[model samples]
Target: SQQGEEDPQALSIQEGENATMNCSYKTSINNLQWYRQNSGRGLVHLILIRSNEREKHSGRLRVTLDTSKKSSSLLITASRAADTASYFCATDVRARVTETSGSRLTFGEGTQLTVNP
Candidate 1:
């Protein structure tokens, strides 16, 4: 079963505004990661939060996790037109005790953010 499903399929905001996105998942995970993708480009890793961590920040971005609720959120401050892009949340699920290959990652559907200048 895949985990990490994002909420709010899309969002629109003006420059300097803030953007927030949420994701929910099923099953236990080792970590959660966020990624951003510009139009016609590949995804770029933004941040990663371990299952034990509750919050993290990087530059204009803030991420929060609530393991009790199996959810996470990403907030981008002072949004710019250049910030318009799609954001996704990914989960690294813990492998079975017998499995040795490695962990598996499941990605969310993604939230499309449009920041108007």
Candidate 2:
């Protein structure tokens, strides 16, 4: 598949600890993004990093990319109970010659993250 796949479809962490997740893809991409979804809310965009960028950080969240291995990782430091949610990695792949320039993301099943108090 040309989509990104995240491992360990679930994770649990303490209120003041860290949580880490990994994603792997099969095709070249223009960019990748991480999003979070609360139990009953819309997905929230966390961060986006281009294929050329190696790393990016937002607040307590950190992301790393390795094009050579077609993989990426997300780390949340000092995770809080409020951080409990499902996380998804999305990628904008290169469109086909006959296709348009825009590329829609194919989401993984997602990781259900729970932060305990």
The residue-by-residue lDDT of candidate 2 on 1-117, one tens digit each, is: 538888878998889999999888888988888999999889999999899999999999999999999899899999999999999998875774235456678777678999999
Q: What is the per-residue lDDT of model 1 for residues 5-99, given as tens digits with 9 covering 90 to 100?
A: 98889999999999999999998888899999999999999999999999999999999999999999999999999999999999986774235
What is the C-alpha local distance difference test score of each model?
0.92, 0.88
Q: How many residue pairs clash in each candidate?
A: 0, 0
lDDT of 2: 0.88
TM-score per model over all chains: 0.92, 0.91
Model 1: CA > 4 A from native:
96-102
Candidate 2 stretches with Cα past 4 Å from truth are 96-101
Task: Provide the global lDDT of candidate 1 against the true structure.
Answer: 0.92
Backbone clash pairs in model 1 (N, Cα, C under 3 Å; residues 3+ apart or in different chains), count? 0
Candidate 1 vs. truth: CA RMSD? 2.0
